[model samples]
Every structure is written in structure tokens, then in C-alpha cells.
Target chain A: MTHLVSIENVDMRYGGASGTLAVAGLTFKVDKGEFAAVVGPSGCGKSTLMRLVTGLHIPQAGHVIVAGQHVTEPVSIVGMAFQNPSMLPWRTTLDNILLPLEIVERHRKRLRAHKAEYVEKAEHLLDVVGLKGFGSKYPWQLSGGMQQRANLCRALIHEPQLLMLDEPFGALDAFTREELWCVIRDLHAAQDVTIVLVTHDLREAVFLADKVLVMSARPGRVLREHRVPFARPRDLEITYDKAFNDVVHQLHGEIASARRAA
Target chain B: MSAVIEDIQKSEPARPLIARIDWVRASPWLYTIALFAIWEASVRFFDLPYTVLPAPSRIFAAFYQYWSPIWKNSLQTLYTTTLGFLMAVVGGLALGLFIGWSKVIYAGLYPLMIGFNAVPKVAVVPILVIWFGIGAIPAMLTAFLISFFPIVVNVATGLATIEPETEDVLRALGARKLDIMLKVGIPRSMPYFFGSLKVAITLAFVGSVVSETVASNYGLGNLMSSAQSQFNVPLVFAGLLALAVEGIVMYSIMAWVERRMTGWAHRSTMSH
Candidate 1:
């Protein structure tokens, strides 16, 4: 697989020079169509690394290259979902899903003429996420899990090359989080989109990602990278397997040691 | 299957229609009726002169006695207030959008805005009269000047307080500043705009009434002032009642609009 994203020896500092160093010499690469999860202790600058890749912030040193272009500004070929669903309160679920299409260039111009077609596409996505018939309801009318599902649909609606999730399932309960993991796994397989998930959940990382990258605590750097040996169409039952628990336990130990060295 | 059937059987019957109704929704009107009844009973028992404190019955009588003039004047007040409020809405939205579009503008103008708002609008009414002469223009100008501040402040706050997460989401999508404002800022500020409308409408009424009492030839304010000078306390109370009704009507309309437009914001689950 070809590399879709490459971050090289990046240094990021918050506030100013005399301020905190958030990331130090962070280097990693994600292959095209790869599902990569970055797992770290809390406050390990995992989110800052996401910012670097998305081009929301330029690193003080080194380069962030996505899809063979050096990112100097916010990249348009990326989609993002956060821990907070952050749906616009004035829009219904379907409208919220249609937001990126309304803003992105190619879709914005055609949206007026093809609104019915777009609406059908949005409803189809909702159906895939178990939100069928919820298109008419306002964000407030839906449950939290439903809103997040809608949010995911919104991110994917524009069909970008890369999808970035920043602790997307962190705010959900255990059962809902597990259910969404399957949803995301299915989406990744169907869409053939490269995904970079910033999360702290080891079980989630082990279950969903093709490769798990561990980051050290603050002034974070890539601590280790472990390629999951599990095959595709991973079942929830696989999580109970001894091999799955072993990989999780190994990463758990690495995270603990990283915290001690902090 | 038995457990499921037993669970269905154990469910309580539906509540009675009246019992299911929300009493809190009707509490306002009920409270109004109770207060009016108490006022009528107290004045009748005390046998007070109408000049001192008119009973609800005598106030209603006065209201009926001069119904035509009262209605005309009430319509006049409503028209002027609405016109002034419309002007405020336009000017406030533009200025608020400008102020909120950037941090520099917000910081530079916020203090000045507060100082301007601090100057009592009632004091400005006389100056407006002197410039434009005693009429509806001065009343309208007063309403605009007094009511526009809340709208500007509220709208600016709404724009300024766009969640950092929300901004990040849009920005990462390569959305331009104008795109963010058009797509998100204006729509997000709507709740705040409607909230400020409720506040500003009430302030608009105060502005109009103050100007009318001091300068205008029509409106319930002028009617009340004249009635007070003549010691027609019942007529004055009738004017007060008219103003109260108008204020309540405007406020309720704005509140209804707010709920209609921004219900998702306040009612949406916060768990995520």
C-alpha cells in the first residue's frame, strides 16, 4: 500500500516559545485505505497530531504531507467527526448530514438542481447507520447515539479521501461504543477510505484498526507500532480470544510505562 | 412469551385527559384572574374612592366608556413600536454581525456600546422631541435607540461564541470565513436574536411610552398622563391595563418564535 499521510519529525508548541511543548519529533505514516488508530494516555497530544494532519495548525518544525501534497492550509480532502456530535441545532438530521455537501465546491453548485437526489443519498446513509425515518427529526429529538450516527453520516457525505475521528466514541456508553465500532468497521471496508482514529480505548483500537500506533505522554512521540494479525470482517466474538487480549495487554503495559517516564 | 404477556398486563391504564394536561402551561392566565379578583374584592370592601384606587369593575367601565379613543391610541402605539423595532432589527443585525465577525471589532466596540446603553433612553427622549418636534418620529427614534442595544449585544455574543470544536470541523473542511459565517454563524445566532427580540420588544414599548408621555399627541402613554393630570385615576388605570396587555402580547409572540426557531439548541441532549 502507498502512504496517504506522512508526518516527519514534527515539533509543536502551544502559546509561544516559553510555553508548553505539546508534541516532539512525532513521526508516523498511514498507508492508503488503511485503518490506523493512535492510542495514548490522556493529554498525550494525540489531538494536536490530528490538528497537524488536518492542516488546522502548521507544525513549528517538519512537514505534514497528505495525499502527496505538503499541507500548508486546511485540507479539503478530509472529513472529521469529534467526540461531541456538534450537530447544528436549527437543522434536522438530514439537513445536518447535507451540510458538507452544501459547503464543498463541486456539490454546492449542483445542490440546488439535484437536491432530491442528494436527499435520497443522505437518507440512505442514515439507514446504513440505523437512523432511517429519523431524517425529519431535529437534533434535540434524537438520542445521543442517534445524533453521533447522524454526525458520522455528515462527515462521510462529501466522500473525501480521508476520514479523521478524534475520540469519536469517547463520549458514548460501552454498549453504544461497541455497536458504533462495528458500524465504523463496516464503513471503512465499504468506502475504502483511509482512517486515522485518535482514541484512548485499547479494546477499540485492537478491534477496529489494522495497525495500532502507541504515543507517549506529553511532548508525545510514536512509542510503538503494532500490526494487528486479525483478518477482515472482525467479529465482536474475536475480542474474547486470547490473542486479542494479549495484544491489548502488551499495549496496556507500554502506556503504563510511557506514563511512568512522563 | 408468558413473561412478555405478564409485563403487558401489568402496565397502568392511560391517564385521564384533564389529568394529563400540563397545569404549568395555564398557570399564567389563572394567576392573572386570581389577582384581578382579589383587587376587585379589596377595593369594594374598603369602599375607596375611584380617585384613590379604582376597582377592576370601575376600570373596565372606564375602558368601555372611552373604547374608541383607547383603541385608536393603542393601535397608534403598536404601529410606532413595530416600525421602530423593525428598524432596530435591521441595524442591530448588521452592526452585530460586523462586531462579531472579528475579535478586534468586538473588543474595540464593546465598551463603547455599554457606555451608550448606560445613558438612560428616557433622558434622550426630550432631545429627540426637540430635534424632530412632538410626534411619532421622536417616539419611533426613542424605541430604536433603546431597543437596538440588546440585539447587537446578543447577536454579537452568539457569533463570537461559536464552539471551537465546530469551527475546527468547518475549518478543516477548507471552508472560507464567509462560508462559515453564512452557513453557521447566522443560523446559530438565530436563537440569540429571538431571545434578544423578546427583551428588545419590551424595551421598545418603554421607549415609545416614555417619548409619548413627554412629547407625542397620541398613544396610551399620552392618554395616561392626561388622565393623571385630570385625576381620572380609573382612566389612567385603564391605560395601564391596555399597555400591560400589549406588552404581554408582544412578549408572548417573540417567545413563541424563539421556541419555533431554536428548540433544537435548548432541548438537544448534551450527553455527547
Candidate 2:
């Protein structure tokens, strides 16, 4: 089976020739419709990896291929969400969600003709995230968690084949984060889109991903790749299992050592 | 914020008639009324000469007597200021977008703009009169020249402040430079644009008045200057009062527009 995303022997250096080497010799693959998570210590270039895959940065020494084509320019089939939702303060929740549709080509061309249909779709997505009746409200009217959910809806609105999330839940409270994890889990099952989540939360990774990859400190490389043995339709009860804690603890030990090594 | 507003609305049915008046919001008007009353009383008690300081009653009398000329000149001043301000909005938006679009343009044009803005606009009036040959043209151009700088600077600042992460999100979705600018940059700059309008409107009035004083035979500035020459001190004070009233009205309108256009920004920042 062809992986939806493949980064082969990728090396990324920030600044010029003499600057910091952010990531080196990194290789990873996520199968089509699979969910994968990358966890690492801070400054381990996990974000650099996201940039490489999203074609925001061309890898120095290797190639990144998505949907069987090399990423020379920004790949159009990717959707991204960052830590800060960063919704435009001017737009209503529904309008903000519809933003990508106005920019991406196929939808942009069809937008005026199908604006009501798009609004229906956006409102439906908002409902899915428990944001029904909030379509008319502006971003500032919503709480932080609500704004993040709106941001997620904005990212997913175009229904890109691949979704890249960089610490999307980092700013949320633990309970809200877990609530979003369930939302994301249901979204993954329903949408069947390939997802690559870059986060520092071990439980978040284990609870949602099919596979979890841990990286070493600066100039990051994949230190370990573990297949999560959880079944589909996971519940919060799974997190309390001894097996889950063991896996998290093991990964935590690995990251601690990686930090010391750096 | 909405919750509090809703609570007030819900409880309004039970409030007494006098208590229902939004006194907190009306405080500015009340304070102005009280200040004028005190000034009228003090002038009457002190028996001050009108030349040193006109009493509020004398100022009102002058206003009544010169209503026709004051009305015509006030209209002229308003027309010139509004026309100049509108031109500035258009010119400044284009110039600001041009300057803010790239670091190269920003670096190249910013210093030149600063130098131009630093040159006192009053000194530029005689030069404007020489080029445009007096009348309302010089006044209008001066207002345009004075007000355009703030709008340009503010819009540029707004456009230049797109968060890096936000740019990345758009880029990863295959948005081009122009796409990012139209979708994100312009809308983001609106709050700043509206804010600049408040400052620029005031400056436009200053420019119009300054040009009128030196170059024009119409407008409140010229009327005041001519009145000063005749030593019609109360009429001069009335002209000053008319100008102040005009300024307040225009400023309030701009403030209302700003609140309407960019209410979300203020709401979020001020939210508990």
C-alpha cells in the first residue's frame, strides 16, 4: 500500500549554510487513511518536519513525496492546524470556516454558485464539533476552546486528503484537550483522511494514533516507532489501562535520555 | 459581554423611568453642559470684558447674529475637509498596501514618508497656495496631504503584522502571495484603517483650517482671521466654538464608525 506521505532521508537546516541544523536524516511514512503522531522534546525539530511535509520548506538533502508526487511547491492536498487557532477577528465562525474554500481553486471557482451549499456544509461541521448556532457569532465571542474547534473546522473544511496538526491541543486545558481528542477520533473514523499529528502529549498520541514515533533532541531523528495496540472506537477507559501507562512511561524515558544526550 | 447586555435587557422591564436612562453613557454630555453653565456664571459674576474673554451669553449672541455667514463658511469648511479626507482614504490605502506588500518597498519608502510627514503641514500651505493658486483647492490639497500619512502608516503596520504561523497555514493550502494578501491582509488591516480615520479626520480639519487662514477667503479659519482683524472678539470666539462643535460632531461620527467596523477586536481585548 502506498503511504499518503513519505519523507525520505530528509535534512532541514534553518538560516544559511552555517546556521542550525534543525532536522537530519529523518525518514517516515504514513499509510493512506492512517493516523500517525510524532512526539519529541522541545526544539527537536518536530515542527520543521511538519514544514518539510507541508512544502513550506524544501528539504536540504532529501525528498518529500505526498500523494505519489514530489513536493516542489506548496502541496494543495494538505490541511493544517497550529497551536493558536488564529481566526480572523472580523469573520463570523461560519465565515472563518469557509475561508479555505474561498482560496483553494476547485471550491473558489464554484463558491458563488454553491455558497448556500457551502454554508450548510460549514454549519454541519460546526454542529459536529458542538458549535451549532455559533455560525453567526464572531471569533472573539467564543471561548478559547471553541475558537480552537472553529480553527479545526476551518482546516478540515476543504476536505484535503492529508491533515497536518502541529500541537493543536497544546494550549487547551486537560479536560478540553481530552474532549477534542474524542472529537478528532470521531472525525478520523468518519472522514477517513490521513493525519499526522505533531504533539508533546504522550496520552494524546497513544489515544488517537495508529502509530506513534518519538524523535531525539535537536537535529531530530526518529528514535522509536511503536504501533499502538488499541482497537477502533477507543474510550477514555483505555487511557487508564496498565498497558497504556507502560507505553507512555517507556516513551517518556526515551525522551528524557534524548534530552540529556543533546 | 453579550451576557451582561442580555441581563440588562432582561431586567429593563422592572426599572423606574429615571433609573432606566443610561447615565453612565451620557456622562460626557452632562459634563459638557455643567462646564458651560459654570463658565457663563463665572463670566457674569466677574464682569469680565468681552475682549479678554467673551461670556457664554455673548458668544451665543454672536453666533445668532452671524448665523448666515457662519453657516455658509462652516459648510465650505466641511465640504473641503470631507473631500480631502475621502481622497486621503483612497490614496493612503493604495500607498500603504504598496509599501506593506514587501520588505523591500517598506524599507525603501518608509524613510521618505517619515521625512515628508515630519515637514510641518502648515509650512506646506503657502507652497500649496502658490501651486494651486488659493481658493478651496489649496485647502483641500493641504488636508489631503496632512491626513494621508497616518492612514498609510497604520495600514502598512496592519498588513506587515500577519503572524508567521497564519501565513504558513495559508501557504500549505497552496495560497499564493496575492491570495494571502486579499484574503488575510486587507481584512486584517481594517481595524487599523478605521482607527487611522479618527486621527486622520482631526488632522484633515487642522489642514483645512490652516490653509484657509493663510490662503483662502472662505471657511471658518478665514472667517475667524477676518473677525480677529475687526476685533469682533465675541464673533471670533463664536467661530472657535463653531469649529469645536464641528470637530466634536465629526470625531464622534468617526468614533461610531470605528466601533461598528471593528467591534470584535475591542470585544476580545476587553473581555473578562
Candidate 3:
């Protein structure tokens, strides 16, 4: 299988007033249609790594290449979701989902004349995300879990080849989080898009991702990449499986080690 | 949990057919009546001099009696104020976006803008009168000077305060700089724009009035000045009342338009 996204020798540093690097010496890659998750303690630059692959931040050193192209600026072929979801309050759930289509080029020219067709597509996505009959409802009218579901749909609406999740389920409750893990699981299973998730939940990482990448604190580095030997079309019950728990326990210990080393 | 419970417990605050309204339901006329009762009583008991202040009843009569003159002067003032305000809106939005969009422009022009805005605009009334020679030009210039700052300040501040994640979302979608400006920058700034318009239109009225006070002899400002000289305080009070009403009317119109434009933003915030 070919790599859909690649980050090579990437170093990102946010300059402090006293002159210091924030996160340094990071490198990673996601193969086509793979669900990859990065797990670490907070401020470990997991988000920085996500930004790098999503073309939101340019690396100070090395390269970020996606689909055989170097990312000097932002690339439109990627979709992104964050912990906050941050849907524009002014727009309806359906309109928010179409936000990228209004911005990216190929979709822009088609938006006006084919608006109804695109709107139907957005409706279908909302339905798949368990938000059917909610396309016209405003963002403020939805619960946090529902809003995050809409956010997931919005990220997927443009159907980008690469999907980036920056702790996308961080704020939800345990139940809702697991529920969304299934939603995301199904989303990726159906779309087969490459997913890069930055997460703190070891169970979540193990349960959803094809491979899990562990990162150290501060100057984040890819300390380990564990390929899940578990079978896919993973049901929620798989989270309770001994093998699944074993992988989660193994990743958890690796993160504890990474934190102490940092 | 509490929120969900609250939603359930308070669900039937009103009946079902009303389409699930939560915040406000009573007719605003109740508040209006309360205000008027207080005003009517205060004037009756205070025994205020008619020259200094008139009773609501007297003001009502004045409202009716001077209707034609008031209307005429208002037309004149409106002409000046609207032209000036339009100019301000155009100039301010353009300058604000240009300054906001570029770091160099922001660095070069922002401080100077602050400095210019800080000067007391009323001082320019005399200079405007002297330069433009009254009638409508001076009044329009004064209105322009007064109304332009809020728009510039609000628009610049709005552009400056864009949410970082939204920018990130747009970037991954490969939005060009201009696309961000039109989609994100402009729409995000609209609340600021509408907020400024509320004050700007009022200032436009004030600017026109100041111009009338300094130079024009036929506007509402001039009519009030003449009424003051003749000790016809009721008419002066009436003029002020008329001005206030006009300001409210214009503000309401602008507000309605803003509500329509920013309905999306408003809806999202309300849910949270």
C-alpha cells in the first residue's frame, strides 16, 4: 500500500520570549486508508504534529508531503476536526458542513448552481452521523455531542483524501466519546480515507486506529508506532476483548515511559 | 445533566402551539406603558418650568403642532446625515480591511488611525463651517468625521479577533487570502459593523445637529436654537424628542438588517 501522507524529519518550534524551541525532531507517516492515532500526555505536541501533516504549520526543518506533493502552504485535499469542533455559530448545521465547499476551488465553482445536490449530500452525511432531521437546525440548538457529530460531518463533507482529528473527542463524556469512536470507526470504514487522530485515550487509540503512534512531551518525537494486529469492522464490544485491552495497556505503559523520559 | 433536566422541567413554560419559545414572550408594550406612567407622573409632580422642560402632554401637543416644520428640518438633516454616513461606511470598511489584511499596513496606519480618532471631533465643526460654508456640506462633513471612527475601529477590531481554529479549518480547505477575507473576515466583522452602525447613525444625527448649531439656519438643530433664543423651551424640547424618535427609528431599521445578516452567528451562540 502507498503512503497517502508523509512527514519527514519535521521540526516545529514556537519561539518563546526567552528564545527556545517548542517541539523539535518529529517525523511520521500515514499509509493510504489507514487509521493512525498519536497518544501522549498533554502539551506533547501531538497537535503540532497534526498541524504539520494537515499543512496548517510549516516545519522549520524537513518536509511535509501529501499525495506526492510538498506542502509549502495549506493543502485543500485534507479534512480537519479539533477538540472544540468550533462550528461557526451563525450557520446552520447543514451550512456549516458545506463550509469547505465554499472555500476550496473545485467545489467553489460548483456551489451555486448545484447547491441542492450538495445540500442533499450534506443531509446524507448528517444522517450517517446520527443527525438526521437536523440539517436546518442551528449550531446553538444542538448539544455538544451533536455539535461534534456535525463537526465530523463538516470535515468529511468535502471528502478529502486525508482526515485529521486533533483530539476530536476530548471534551465528550465517556459514553459519548465511545459512541463517537464508533461513528468515526464507521465513517472511516465506509470512506476508507486515511485518518490521523491525536488522542489521550489509549483505549480509543487502540480500538479505532490501524496503528498507534506514541509521542514524548514538549519536543515531541515519534517514540513508537504499534501496528494493531486486531481485525477490523471493529465493534464496540472489541474494546472489552482481552487482546484489545492488552494493546491499550501496552500503549498506556509506553506513554507513561515517554512522559518520564521527557 | 442539570441542563437536560432544566430543559425538561421548563419545557412547558408556555403552551405547545407557540412553537417552543424560551427567552421572552410578553408584549413589549407593557414596558412602554410603565415608562410613560413614570414620565407622566414625574412631570406632573415636579412642577417643572415649561421653558426648561415640558410635560408629556405638552410634548405630545408640540409633537402634533410642529409636525410640518419638524418634518421639513428632519428631511434636511437626513439628507446631510445619510450622505455623510454612507461615505463613512464605505471609507471605513475599505480602510479597515486594507489595514487589517496586511501586517505592514496595520503597522503603518493603525497608530495614526488611533491618533486621528482620539481628537475631539466637535472641534472640527467650526473649521468645517468655515471651509464648506454651511447649508449641507459642513453638516455632512461633520457627520462623516463623527461616524467614520466607529466603523474603522469596529471593523479593524473585528478583523483582528478572528478565531484561530476557523482559520485553520479554512487553510486545510486551501482557501485563498481573498476567500478568507470575503467569507470569514467580512461575515465575522458584520456584528461589529452592525454594532457600529447603531452608534454611527446616532452620531450622524449629532454631527448634523452640531453643524446646524454652528452654521445652518433651517435644520432641526437651527430650529431648536431659534426656539431657545425665543424662550420657547417646549418647542426646543419637542425638537429634541423628534430627534430621539428619528434616531430610534433608524437604529431599529439597521438592527433588523443586522439581525437578518448575522442570524446564523446569533443562532449558534444562543445554543451554547
Worst 10 residues of 1 chain A by lDDT: A138-147
**lDDT digits (tens) for residues A42-121 of candidate 2:** 99999998899889999889889999999998887899999999898878989999999888888999999999999999
Expressed as tens digits, the lDDT of each residue in A152-258 for candidate 3 is: 99898888998899888889999999889999999998886889898888988888898998888887888889999889788899889898898888888888887
- Model 3 chain B is weakest, by summed lDDT over 10 consecutive residues, at B17-26
**What would the per-residue lDDT of candidate 1 be over residues B34-85, giving only the tens digit for each residue?**
9999999999999999999999999999999989989999999998898899
What C-alpha lDDT does candidate 1 achieve relative to the native structure? 0.91
Q: In candidate 3, how many Å is residue A197 off?
A: 0.6
Taking chain A of candidate 1, what TM-score results?
0.98
lDDT of each: 0.91, 0.91, 0.84
**Which candidate, 1 or 3, would have the higher TM-score against the true structure?**
1
CA lDDT of B163 in candidate 1? 86
1 against 3, candidate with superior DockQ: 3
| Cα lDDT tens digits for candidate 3, B1-272 | 23212344556856563354332433355566677778878888998777766877787788799899989998888888889999998988888788778678888888898888777767888787777777888888888988988898888878877788888889878887788787778878888887788889898888888888778877889989998899988788888888887888888888888788777666655655
Counting only residues 3 or more apart in sequence or on different chains, how many pairs clash (N, Cα, C under 3 Å) in candidate 1?
A: 0
Best by DockQ: 2
Off by over 4 Å in 1: B1-29, B259-272
TM-score of 2: 0.91
Pairs of colliding residues, candidate 2: none
